[model samples]
Target: MAADCEAWLNANPVEAEDLSDSFISAEEDNGGSGGTNKNIHNEINGNWLSSSSNNLHEARLKAKAKRRLRKNSSRDSGRGDSLSDNGEVARGTPIAPTSPKSKLLDRKSRMGKGRGLPKKGGAGGKGVWGRSGEVYELVEVDKKDPNFDEDQENCVYETVVPPLDERDFEKTVTPIVQEYFEHGDTNEVAELLADLNLGPMRSEVPSLAVSLALEAKASQRELTSRLLVDLCGSVLSHSDMESSFDKLLRDLPDLVLDTPGAPQLVGQFIARAVSDQILSKSYIEGYKGKVDCEHARAALDRAAVLLKMSLGGLRIDTHWGTGGGQRPVIQLIKEMNLLLKEYILSGDGKEAERCLRDLEVPHFHHEFVYEAIVMVLESRGEKTFKMVLQLLKSLSLSSIITVDQMRRGYERVYMDIDEINIDVPLAYFILEQFVDKSFRMGIIGVKLRDQCPHRNRKRLVSEGDGGVVKFERY
Candidate 1:
């Protein structure tokens, strides 16, 4: 039995307890018999230990192999089936792959909810968590429908403005006409009028424009005439313009109360409008003999007279004549120069002053001052200078040219004195003398003397005895 146990132990060599010392001690105490029994016990113990360890290792390896197979099987299930290196399926049954969406649906179904989180506190069913509520079904919209919109629903709305009556028209149009008078842009006025719902009172525009111009200045009348021509076919129809003039003719008696020359001005407006085709030729013919009011008759007669003049249509543009600041700068300069030349040749101070007054440009009198000073500087004779000086004094004394204007004029000359010196070598000296005389005459202020530019006089050089150079100051 001991030999069989030892043979089993040799076949499966494994770690076991050391029994050699116990067996040796037993043999010494009980001879051959006790030694055999001790060997048998040791062999039994070694056999038991080896068999238990071998069984445990085999069980553990089997469990490990089973776990590996389960892991591979799970991985292959997700990818349909395991694929071999040769691109062949290595599976029992090929499973279909699951999409993420299907997987999500499966997960949701498993949780007993189709989509979204369970309602707060377990209240489940549609909107803001579940009591009975209105359910909205989303329906596809037809894009071919006329009222359909993708981004927003189509909406219809209407804005209506009350039509202007005669009184309302006057109130609304008064400021527009005034602004037109200032800017003098007919297109702007037309654009403004286009925005208004004039309705049946459209005829009132022409009459109101002319009436306002009559009460205002000559320039306003000219602008009003131009506006009538521009707005003829556009804003104001031919019929509207005719009706407007009829109203103006009827209102002449009232208009003459404020503007004594209203009849004449209206006549000019009518003639110009007719010539420009804004008013029909038959317009004046219609009122030829039926006119009752004397002012109206006078206006009609004046219109007739202007229409009969040669080149009347073209000439009527200058009927008002440019006045004050309205006249072109070049024209004003020419007229002023003529007045100065005439004054120099004739020595008539009153006539020169009268001509300047008639120019109607008190605002631009500084230009005259600059021109007169330039004339004096350019001229040779003392008499001509004295004459220009006398005219300036006369203007100053009469208050036609303000002291401020005179000072500005001298300052302008001072600013350009260097340029003037190119033409007139004695410009600085002449300017100084003129300023002194004018200051003493009270034509220029006392402060003007300090403002005048001083030019350094050139030094005279001469050779003295012993070849020495001497400098003489002017």
Candidate 2:
């Protein structure tokens, strides 16, 4: 019985216990004592039944199991009754032998869940490295036998990505797509490319390129608006794709914007353009006058924030275009001023200060700092002015001190205008600078209304002050 069980284990593989169970059960019914039970006749075909049929019953069980086996059958089908070696399918059919591996892969994948390894073969002691492309092998269910390797046999795959056409259209297509994007003409491009194929798109053109484009569309829409899109074509020159690209990039909001790296690409282009102007600074700036490379810098900034870009990636290679003698410090201050104003309008003092810190324009002089102080102090309340002074004097910019300054300033000048017994006219002009920065320099003055232009503007003049006069129209 031990030998029999061992034989069964070897031939049938104890791992497939259900098969073992079936054979054992049928054998017990036939009486293991070398005789066939009458019950066996009805359960199995009678042609092989024997009076001394324990052997016959065993033969029947084996035969039934072989017939039911899912693996290769070339094993025992010799005289149309006996199996040949290695249990293969009968010759002449194209179907290959059904190994334990191929069968389970088919079954498991059908369940909508995928499995990593197969049940047998291509691993462990004997049959591993069995085929090419079998990079690694895994162990069997009990870690008993070699199980699976994702070799050519196991990991059958189908490559569907269309091969890149080295010369056909990529060069032409890449520029066209970029240009269209720069021009804010994606809708036009999409329309033109509608129903178009890369050569010829399959119905599966749910293919990669199309899918990527689809994923990119929603973000593009959110970042772009019709007004800004028009600005791209109008404010930015069509010939300089960098201009349009930079414009679009700058329009992105500080929060909830497009992918971070996006600006880097735009920035690279702008940097290149600026470098070009720099390389040709004599001739180009002579013609263009004070080149607005600010757009380019902004594009680079957007790209850096969006793409998390590295400076090494930029390809700036331009010679000077103009103002060879003038340093960019003044221009940098102007840019910083614009940014600062926008930051204030957006109610983000923190970012405005950071911008001031990062300003690296070589021309930034003490005068610029002094100008900044005058502008800040004159336009803001006395208390607010003090806070600006404190922030400048502080070793490191601190938020707490800045807040305290603002609170004191607002309370002092804004809340108690009447106590000063000051000239109402001078007071009106003095306070109005908070509304328009130019008021600080006496270049222009502002009117105060509680609401904005379309609505009411804040009233800069104090209540019951005879000097109060409403501000003028735009």
Candidate 3:
């Protein structure tokens, strides 16, 4: 197009000298006539010449294209024949790709192409950014960037992709869960456990699930925690009400009571554990709840009997069953009494009285209020001999005396220290000035060596109303 425009301008030069000097100028009409005649003739001739030049240029282009195509066909035919003669392609000689896009495929497979391509910049004629491995053509962004609203030079344009959910970014989601329990997707797993249908797997669910949840919580396995909590609930539910009265003795456990639960739930759970013989033996014997009505007393006695029978199978000290385990049972009893105290405080003296009767504490020396503990080993329904004890084994004489409002109970030989509730300066005064003073005297024993024919003589002594003993001093 440029050449055609230039030719037209050169041929039409105004000055004769300029026309002669022009590269594309027409010949002058040196043999022609006047300026008017010459001007008309020149106009006619110029029009024809321009049309002729255009036609000739188009024809020349078509001929050149045909020649080049013919040469290419010849070269291809020759190469095909040579290849047909041999079994394999020549080394280092690249075979022509059958497809129009083969040129690109060949280049892509070359080693280190990625490294070299980026430096060369864009693929094809795109210039700067064309060579992205699997290239995407850049469409000019017609929208103005909102970030430009701020005049600061901090605007950064990142490659835009669709927003992704966790599934789309799992490589990243793994860590996201770990950051914190509340926010992380890891809870989804636990939630899934919560959703599990327990219809067929009810029993197994708790055992399996609780173990897993505990493990996860302990080991910090966030993914596993969901199932764990769900399982814990199931285990707790199953532990209750599955055992029977006979098995109750061995089934009760202090742990069942100690585990966190609604008060009622904990009590029920303990009852069930006891029924199943799952409680520690010592625990059964000593089991106590806040309430000590006939129901709890019966349960406690049943547990204690079973514990005694099942001692062989129990350790009750450290791991399984041992002597230390007996403490939990003691605790249960104490707890029951404490509950009774609450009843007493609440003006439910009738219930409190019932509790004292069930525990076999003297009717007046109610268990919680009375300082003495009367331990009776009854046999054959006969109340011949009695042994009195204190609830908390060791107590300072001072506190015991002040706290000993109820009269201390008595055994056949040992007076119930609880009898102090009777009167006078009370237990404190008795312990400080009377019981502790003379009670220290060792038991009286007659010398068998010189006691003619082993006759028990002069071995008897007695105490006065003040617990002071007088001896014959022989």
Candidate 4:
């Protein structure tokens, strides 16, 4: 019967309409037992429908179960079973979730493996673990090592400068002092001194500077005095200054050989230094009786006289007197006039040259030139004119007055010739003669000759007389 049922199910597919028709036909054919048959047919139909639905549900459930089994198998394979201590597999062990730090370490370990780096327990790169069973310790840098200097390891070095000696100091400082004389900049001199390692020879600075001043012009002496004052207590200590002045006193005889007035100048320097506090009061007193050299004694006496003056040591500052450009313009003019007047009286070219040198106004030589030419023009006697001309010639030949200065002087006279003519009617004639003479003597250039002014001569006719008087310009 089961075979028949299976064969019937396989041959005829179940349809709702066909099933309903079969139920209705069975009900009709069994009408005498209709109620019982109808009940039975309903039961059979219900069972068949329920059985089909159940079979579909069972099939879906089986497929889901199979998927679950396959997933479990894959998951279990990926995380193989852990072994017990007895070597038996342990089932159903929970895996704890991996932390981020552990995961990163795991990834690093994998990367290290690819690079052929040893594991944590094995020795490999620097500072890594040793491969031996016993862990090897890392070697530390020993502090006692002969070449070890932690500070020096990171330090940078600079080049060391060698010290300068005495002869070298003199050679270097002489030009420096000469330059100071030219510019008279004490601060600049101080900066230059600071650069040098004067060492123990620092006391030599004042002596050398004063010595140079003694031989130099008054302007240089004044500058040197100021230099000593500025450098005192700063570059040169009080002791250095005293020793230097002592040395200068001892060397005064030698200094006087070249400069006859060295004693007086040294006296002035000593007084000035003492007044400026570069040297103490005892500096002069120390040599009062002990100074055996006549020059040194004279210097000390001069210093004593200066200190005893009403103005006290203050007078020493002006001891050298202001010469060069330091003097007032009017004072300079007066001095120059005095110099010219003295030259006129004495008629000594050497004395005139000496006075000009004492003036120390090389830059103002043009003024001297102008004064000389004007003096010649104002003078009446030929001898005076010749004397002035001779002086100009001497100055020109000696280069005491440059050609540029001579030309400028002549040009100045020409510019003011008309005014000069108002004062002295014969001024034009005298200037013409002077220019011609100077040009002939090669004291001035030809440019001045061409520039010489010519006076205009006019002809006058007497009224009603018809007589012509020719007015001639000298």
Candidate 5:
């Protein structure tokens, strides 16, 4: 019966890929499942229409109708290429369902040996066991391993372009000096210099900058001067005076001589430095000597020329015009002395000491000590009296005032203080302080012992009950 059915199917093949849908559609088109089921009903003696069989047949009819509708739409849309003439699904066509409950049905009804059966496992194709329980074997794919080879050739390369000198110069040096000119801080400039390995050549930076500025057009000259002024000021104001100030002092004369209008600017700076006590009187004096020596040498050279010209002289009258020849040295010395004397006279021991550090003459300490004592004694203020003695002690320790200088300064101060209505015996308090400081310092030079004024000996020995006056001379 199956062969006869197959022969009939071969004679009339379905256009759609699903053969089960063809059978269901043919039965439905003939009448319905009711007609076919009626034949089975009669064959089963009216008991053929069981609830399960009826339900199965109804689900099959619904699935067949859905397939027939899909096939009609595909044919109208020109998608009938998915159907084969021999009732096989074309490659890439989806498998159609047998019924809505296809998943619940046994595998026997869902899959069978047919033209639309899934392809067997070959060359990595996916496969399942056949209904007879034959297993599909899995195929292994071969892969090619990668091959690596190293190629090494001459790779060293040199820059074909010349080294950029200006760029490097701008990077390493120009920016630092430019910033220094913008901000007048020597320590910052020094740090920058150290970073660039130009620390030791610091003075050169400003000198070079000034030269460049001078060579620039007229419009930039003022800017050059201003930046140079700031740079020089920073160098002078640096706290590391031993290095910064001392080096500048050595380099300054040459800088001033070489650069035009430099002496005037430098002269102004020196004046400011002295006024502010940023530099010592000794430095000012040395600067003065340099200027004077240069001037004297120039003058002598002119005189020698004049003397030589006089041998053929009708008369050569050459007028000497003063230009950049003025020296501030002598004036600076007067200022130093005036400030020092004022501090001493005011009984300001601290200020006097500050001035004392700048004094060009060490012998002048005796004068300062004497004047300080006299100021204190005359004021007769207890604080002033103590300040003078402390100042003298400080001077002695610094070796600025020797034991002998103190002895003489003491006698002179005592006599002056005594003449001001201070008790003659009270004057011994001052002398006693000197003697004690001298002894404490291990200075027993005969000048101190011998210079003790004969008349003040009695005053020095006289006892007093004042808080500071009564201490023993020893």
Candidate 6:
């Protein structure tokens, strides 16, 4: 039997204890031995039952542990599946419950915010992170690759400008000045000059303009000269341009004197301008009315002097008339002076008649000499007063300037007595002498107003403190 047991044990070596327990339990149930065997069977049966119960309890515990493991595994796998929805994961990873807990916690944390923390990504949602806690980095989309150097090899940048030459200068500056002269648009002139970088040379603009005009065609020369005159007129119209025009006009004398043949050219220029009616006597008078009198006088005087100087030495090729054989610029220069003098003695007829001999245009003699007698009365100069009286005597003898013309002339020069600048008594004396002479000459209908028209006249009688006497006509 022991040999058989040994063979059985060897046959089932791994389950030897289990087989022995079962065999012992079966033997206990049979009850085939004596009292000693029976007692042993009873104890063995009790031990077998306890061992079986313990084995069943252990099996249940193992099954319960396996179920718990499966449930937990499914829960972790579901969380891993959700995370897989977010993105794929690497293989063999024992997914932890941390995924669902972390996600739920992350959601709850986001909801509890007051002022929220700044998001992980900035503008354009760049560099965002995934739900799986993975990072997504930003990269250049439209920008050229900074790493490439192929374009740099073929490109270059130049900083230096080529120098401007004379041809280009003429091409650029000539049209600008010409347009200015034509339209008389000062702002356009300024803007064009500024574009050419010539704004800094503004003081030389007029001279440069003149040079350009001389270089222009003869057909356009008259227009250019007229433009210069208009430019001067516009410039002199403003108070700020007074000094500029003065400076320009002052510079003209030197320009004429220093340059050979310039005066003759200028003379021809003036003759053409005058004939074209570009330089009108009325326009010049209007310009003089606009500018300072001193400047106007100086400019005219300088031009006259320049012409006279030209006549002194230079023999210009140009002549004034076709067959009249007149000198070109000399007559115009004299005419300029005569016009200035006529302007100076505008209202006084007696002075106008006396100065009429100096004027070439006899048509204006009536306009100029209409107030000669009044001019003599208003004269502050003793010589001018006597000369005017002598002219009136000669006119009275010739019966040219009649008593009616004298009356009209007197009425014109007569302002208020207080406004008169000459000595009142002396003026009255001169007037009395003229009246006595008119009476002796058998001039009838000579009218005269006695006593000052404006009663605000004062006289010095005795050359003392009480000499000043105020007279009022009643």
Winning model by TM-score: 4
What's the lDDT for residue 352 in model 4? 92
TM-score of each: 0.54, 0.20, 0.17, 0.62, 0.25, 0.22
* lDDT of prediction 4: 0.76
Ranking by TM-score: 4, 1, 5, 6, 2, 3
Per-residue accuracy of model 5 over 1-474 as CA lDDT, tens digit each: 445544544565534335454343435656654444435422233465654454454445545666776764554353444543345665445444445374456453222234554445222344533445556678533333233222213356654533334446456666665565445455676565545534344445544454444333322333443444444454433333324434433454565566554444333333333333444545544533354444333433343344445456523221211111121445544544576457545867567666555443455445555665555544545555455556666767777667666666655654565464445445545555555554555543545545543343343333564344543321
> How many clashing pairs does model 1 include?
0
**For model 1, what is the alpha-carbon lDDT of residue 132?**
56
Task: Give each model's clash number.
Answer: 0, 48, 32, 0, 0, 4
Candidate 6: TM-score? Answer: 0.22
Candidate 3 lowest-lDDT run of ten: 378-387
Residues forming the 10-long window of minimal summed lDDT in candidate 1 = 14-23
lDDT of 1 by residue, 350-428 (tens): 8888888878788899999999999888774577667778888999999999988888888899999999999987777
**Models ranked on lDDT:** 1, 4, 5, 6, 2, 3
Please provide, for model 4 over 82-151, each residue's C-alpha lDDT reduced to its tens digit, 9 standing for 90 to 100: 4433556646542322353654565343222355545554666687556668755688767899989899
lDDT of model number 1: 0.77
- Model 6 scores what on Cα lDDT? 0.46
Cα lDDT tens digits, model 2, 90-206, are 442223334657655654443333355654443454645555456666844443336634453456576564533535444434444445434655466544444234442211211
The 10-residue segment of model 4 with minimum total lDDT is 14-23
Candidate 3 segments exceeding 4 Å error: 1-71, 74-78, 81-279, 288-290, 308-474
lDDT of 6 by residue, 295-370 (tens): 3344454444444555576322222221111224455445534643464456354554444433333333333343
Q: Which candidate is the best by lDDT?
A: 1
Candidate 1: regions farther than 4 A off: 1-156, 311-314, 322-327, 338-364, 374-406, 415-434, 437-446, 453-474
Better of 4 and 5 by lDDT: 4
Cα displacement (Å) at residue 417, model 2: 24
**Candidate 4: misplaced stretches above 4 Å?**
1-148, 151-160, 310-314, 457-474
Q: Residue 458 CA error for candidate 3 (Å)?
A: 99
In candidate 2, stretches whose alpha carbon ends up further than 4 angstroms from where it belongs are: 1-263, 266-330, 339-347, 362-365, 380-383, 393-474
- In candidate 5 the C-alpha lDDT for residue 289 amounts to 38
lDDT of 3 by residue, 204-303 (tens): 3322222222222322332233323333443324332222222322322432343322222223333334434444334544445633444444445544
